[model samples]
Target: MTGAPIVHTASGPVRGSWRDAGTPNASAAYLGIPFAAAPVGELRFAAPVPPEPWTEVRDATSYGATALRRDPGGTLIPEPPIPGDAILNVNVFTPAVDDGAKLPVLVWIHGGGYTEGSPASPWYDGSRFNRDSVVTVSLSYRLGFDGFGYIDGAPHNRGVLDWIAGLEWVQRNIAAFGGDPGRVTIGGQSAGGGAVLTLLSMPAAQHLFHGALALSAALADIPADVAKERGERLAGILEIEPTLAGFRSVSESRILKNQPKAVGGRKGLGLLSGLIDDGLPWGPIVDGELVLRPAADALRDGIGADKPLVLGATDDEFTMVADRAPRALRVVPSTALLRGVLRDRGVRRAYLRANRPQRAKGSAAMVGRFVTDHVFRSLVVRVAEARREADAETWVYALTWVSPTKGWACHCLDVPFWFDGLDRERVSDLAGPNPPQSLADDMHGAAVSFVTGGAPGWPAWRTEPGTARVFGGHPQITTTAYDNTLALL
Candidate 1:
């Protein structure tokens, strides 16, 4: 089918192919266009430098360069090849914008452990959001070591650089596609959600995005030294030094393939996942230039007081990570690990007194619950409190509708419901036979509302318990669901 008339991007004008699978009835369309300089060869581990503007318009109909591919079996994904180097790119979906007025903008970031996941993943298709009257956009960023990785002498968090660049492209050109530059809302699940949290605290990111929907993440503190060591190891495997000049001499795919092995033993690290947050050669840094401070700490200090925020998590978030974690955390099986973990958080006494697992499953569940609450739930509270610190609008949520098969509501389970796509996965089918159609409808509508005006029919979270807005089964605006879990945690 013929696509929309060619829209002019800042670099040049381009066109898109019309969609055969657009919104249920209407013809929502897609346009994949490049936005930055290619990061091949020498540009490998450097901070994403800007691309030169083009005189000739590039065809934006096809998906631009995706960093690289990944094997979901491992922790990190490999960087993939794009059409050329122009690494900055965005895929957009819009309802026909004939007589234009400003439309809400939604920029989506796909999740894959900061290394995996592509902007073109089918699950992130923007058709539905487009039909709902929001301008939907997805972009390609650096993956694995190409985007993340802590290497000495290398710039930090190139992935974040890529995201900011995409936003810059949107600000300069999305008006052509019928979107408002001032009303952009960035959001995503898992790592993408984590990115949203990071962007929230970034001063460089302040004016670019006005709102964010963090689906199931707030992961932004990278251990610099550890992460840099990881990058050095990745460098060692490729027989290259961990410096920018050394890494630039290697092949993209080879460098990507050697990613998982760079960290050595998974168990030896003590954590199931090992993403370093070291300042330079690793994760997001506290560099005076890039990241200013720990995002959570900044939020709790009220940095992003004006922007609206959405916070939530699935009940079984641990199920996916714990599918194998049960056997893992259960290792130092003497309850020493549990005690140590709590003590580290400075709440061991309170946790032990509140938690008394009486059965094996309860014991396992307790461990899983502790991890979930410590990592995610605490972050959720942290973000909301940060929003509250600034006296900004913050809505708190708990995805209480547990997946039927697994009692723990687990991570990523909320994606189906949030997308109103519960029927798309077998797990969702098991989570709830018919699943509550109202859950998706309400949640999606609430998202649209939140992006537009800072709310979704629930009260803002106060420093209280059981007051979370549940996202299922008539979707109650209540509290006290996981207070006991918090106490035990």
Candidate 2:
């Protein structure tokens, strides 16, 4: 505790520094420890391989390389890309170094639509969780075409394989960091949240963690035929074969440049239509192997029935996008705009009737809410409905706290509250000044309780289907939290 805290991992001894040293909230932070070998050369598109052992104590004071090569400007989360070959790494924070302490663990995955995101973000720091006696970890994996794009000879779902590898490392070495491997909980937001759900449904991944937390999860269960078509189109654009060898011949920059065209990047109205028609283009594909089916289907078939889960999304996940073109959106009637996204007349009428309040907000708000319901909120309901008969409990919640600056309880607004990271940098940009610390205390407390005891301080969805804890101004339980989204199903 005096010098730099050093914990001996299976691979080697790692030296970490302490945060808030000499304070009650102080914790040891082991940063940028590789869980897998550098994915370069022959290993670039293959399954993750264990990292090589080191004799000397590796300095883990700084974050390791991230899969994202360039900065994606204007993101809600500050996912700064760090450049290096060893991108498959993990960052750990612990309250103590004693192996016998046997504290619970929270393994978080950062969200960036599967194309971008870094574990190096300040919002993801685990000091608060560590202070609550939970060992926390953040990890990085290959993104976009390099990780999920289909190639003839390469392994499928390499990003998913990286997740498994990271969890495997935790299982083997977390005890040394004073964490109980059996109490591990996997949590994430956006694409990262989708990853948590995907892992929960995976038969092979059931042993990695005992609980799950999915916030505004966006699943990309692309069909095999669609994946192959996109892969072939990408290869054709680059004038190369769609084989692993041909793709390996091209530079990562070239692939990054041309990958968008393969997925049909539309503009304006076409963009909205394209999104509603086709979900995320790059993510975990159903290969009939590791990921045998769509996550919801697997969950319905009882695939993660034994594990506890907490899932939900904010009230206005992406309505702020509508605020960008208020003038144009104002002129378009809500019904006319809804036609572009929801083709079914009966379903559209039902959805509109269910969400009369959103419809009154104007066409832009109505369309935006529709997109949010279609992509995120509805998934939460679907997953809960899928696990209705399962033995393990499922708790649902909604983040209804509206940001004064953003004007809506938009996406990424709930993350800071969940992590108790309202004080972290850039949070004010989204959360506004003087965000409530009481909300953070309640949300973070529930998360800590769930990670340690396998249940959030709320009634399970199974106990009363459609029941959900609402986190916002005057937090309370609501039975019709996702009533509007139910029309879509």
Candidate 3:
């Protein structure tokens, strides 16, 4: 890929380029092309509008702008990779559109706690997948305060709105890239995984994708009352009235800085400063128009009931979250917390009945497991159960493959393996070398199968409750991965 070329977009003609990596006849790859207008300046805090047509051919060869993001060291990915509103962009890697075959489409959403991430992330390289007969598309949506702020006057869930915009772009232009507008599979991990679920619940998103894969998705649906309370608290923190008009005036900096406080219920549980709800005014609203129904509510009534889902979660979920700080373990007195967690996991009697020393080990293990189950594992269960009850076919899996880094099948271990890009980050002293290639090949193959066929290698998850496959050592069937933890909840 040398310079940028203009690609036709629905709104108008936009500029992009064909990337030529040494990967051999690399498909026409376009990166960082905006799908929606940049939400900046006066546009900030508003529902995203499609980007206007460009006058001349703009350079899309170079990665365009990225939303504000704190890199691994908490710097910012957008500082150099491009800049701002360009964040609402999409990257396409296709095997030539005119080839005449309607190919399967896999659109990827990156994960960063809904705070920091971009389409340019290395793990999302679609080269391998594209080479294997699938047209892969990765995109960047708004992130952090820019994407999820709850300003009164501002629309909520800007990130999701951006996602919808990206999907809409895929609908309008993907055919040119050789993708079937009908056979799209939307997928993501962690927060992105949560987004996959959110999309399922969104009425506006129904026609956008045919299948979904949610990997380690931490789906959190805050009640309307709780979310309102959070809006008030965030407003107070910014010294503004909780009202929308008042909060809208607060700087984006204030909103971003205060978001982490909202993550774990700084004000209260349902009050967590997260996804918008009721009428998601900001993103994917359930206003009976855009969303039609809440995602969780939709699953309950079988509203988005038509689409099948493939959902998976790691065994020790929170270990990855905990990995953020090893020293914090000392303060948490994880040992004591472990005992209570085990008791909470329906193993109080069983754990207590064990020898004292054994009880302690059991408690420790259960604590990590409980945290995992609570934050993410439960979501996988709830989504599956809800789908199954609705008579929908959904596949569930529990990944027991432990990483050499001591992080038990923790967060985001799937993407690299799925995209077969592990070697890029393998030498990081912080984590293990790319998961064993066999594991990567197996996972990637499953994803390929799912996109190509309706199966991901393993048997479909049954609605009989608690039936699933554990993709590890022998890929065997298991029931209620954490029955103890479920009873605890």
Candidate 4:
């Protein structure tokens, strides 16, 4: 079991591959193991059903199919394309494939703003975690309209249901992979991070995972009205009713073809084509059914109150947008010019109020800060604050390490460090060569510590120091690093 990478899951036996050829200490990677049935044909837009048990041993040697999604613009991070119908699969990485180990499990939900991304990304390889004695599970769930659309025919939040199904699979079978399901920590970055919070609010998701880590949690919830509008637009584009029957009648190819148009069809927000266009068509919505309330309110009302949690964002989450923005706009924007571009008056006011007399005026940095705080950073703070009020065991952190090459501590910058993926060339491209191994050790260690032991070797937010770990070349614990800006938001 340790050397050959064979383990029996609840469904059947899977043969995985070892990171190193034959080293006993090397991690075993079980790739593309189906946890749920293929959501094709009749199952399209439906809640995931448990995958049928296989009598034969499945080859879990290669990465599985990714969910159907189209990247609107080339992302800074590279994601490889892996094709197939069994997208509702989970990849497992374990140090030992015997029940005697009982290692802690970290189930990762990948982030792509809920529209794109998959567990198949090279950056998501979990062998590094396995090296730390963690049983890491990376899963693929439905994305875009199939995942989050509020259609008339389909139950909302099907993607989330897929996650639940995957977790259930882990609970039933991880023991054979030397994992203790009772010690599972659900974590992800961006949209995946948002899912972590969303699941925390869900009663059905309770007890599925004991602890949570949300990296730069995008806690924004789509209003039911907005979701409905997007759904209607998609339906109209298809020339059919917005119900499940009508949507199911349409081919997945057609759905994927028109998806970008359906998303960009919004009057103002034309999808995430650039840094300026901040809106996305499909995302986690407060459907009043699955998500009864916003995450902060849900936490305030005692949801996930007892769960050990770790949450934080990079210092400059939107700098990528700023850097990529048109030179005329980002290099130096006039106050009036900025206001003219601020389409929504309330946002304009928020930006004006948030910017103080002390800070720099009318520059891309200021604009980036506004977008960063508004979209992600502020929500992390709010959720953390609410969780703190509930007396939940919570530790917060901010990755302030700016890559010497990248210059800005942009969004997704901290991912490779957390995954201990600096060895990967693509990761090194983002993190820069000679990216401090010690820092990767610190951040990766923190995640492993949190997943395994429920505490990341840092003082809780409610403790005397009142600090949040600032991870970098010289990581430190500081109190209220963004308190002043957070107050304005």
Best by TM-score: 2
User: How should the candidates be ordered by TM-score, best one leading?
Assistant: 2, 4, 1, 3
TM-score of 3: 0.83
Give the per-residue lDDT digits (tens) of candidate 2, residues 1-489: 589999999999999999998889989999999999999998989999999999999999999999999997888889899988999999999995577688999999988889999999999999999989999999998999998999999999999999999999999999999998988999999999999999999999999999999989989898988988999999999999999999999999999988989988664445555668988879998999999999999999899999989999999998887766559666798999888677889998999999999888888788778888988999999999998865657999999899988999998999999999999999999999999999999999999999999999988898888999999844389788988898899
- Top candidate on lDDT is 2
What lDDT, from 0 to 1, does candidate 4 have? Answer: 0.79
Tell how far residue 107 is off in model 3, in angstroms.
1.1
Worst 10 residues of 1 by lDDT: 273-282
Q: Provide the overall lDDT of each model, using Cα atoms, as 2-decimal numbers.
A: 0.68, 0.91, 0.65, 0.79
TM-score of each: 0.86, 0.98, 0.83, 0.91
TM-score-best of 3 and 4: 4
After best superposition, candidate 3 residue 469: deviation in angstroms? 3.2
RMSD of 2: 1.2
Give each model's clash number. Answer: 29, 0, 6, 1
Against the true structure, candidate 2 reaches a TM-score of: 0.98
TM-score computed on alpha carbons, candidate 4: 0.91
Report the lDDT tens digits of candidate 4 across residue range 359-394.
263365666666676677777677777887888888
2 or 4, which is superior by lDDT?
Answer: 2
**Over the stretch 1-489, how does candidate 3's per-residue lDDT look in tens digits?**
544444565655555545454456466677777787777766776777888786665556656677654444532122224455456888887764463468999999877666666677666767778877788898887765557655556666667788888898899888767788888999898778878998888766788999898898865454445455656666766787865567557766667677656444322112211221221212233334344555666886775677778888877655444444345442454446555334454455543333243234443444455466556776777777778778877888777777677646655655667777667644233237545778678778888888877678666667357777676645367675545445433
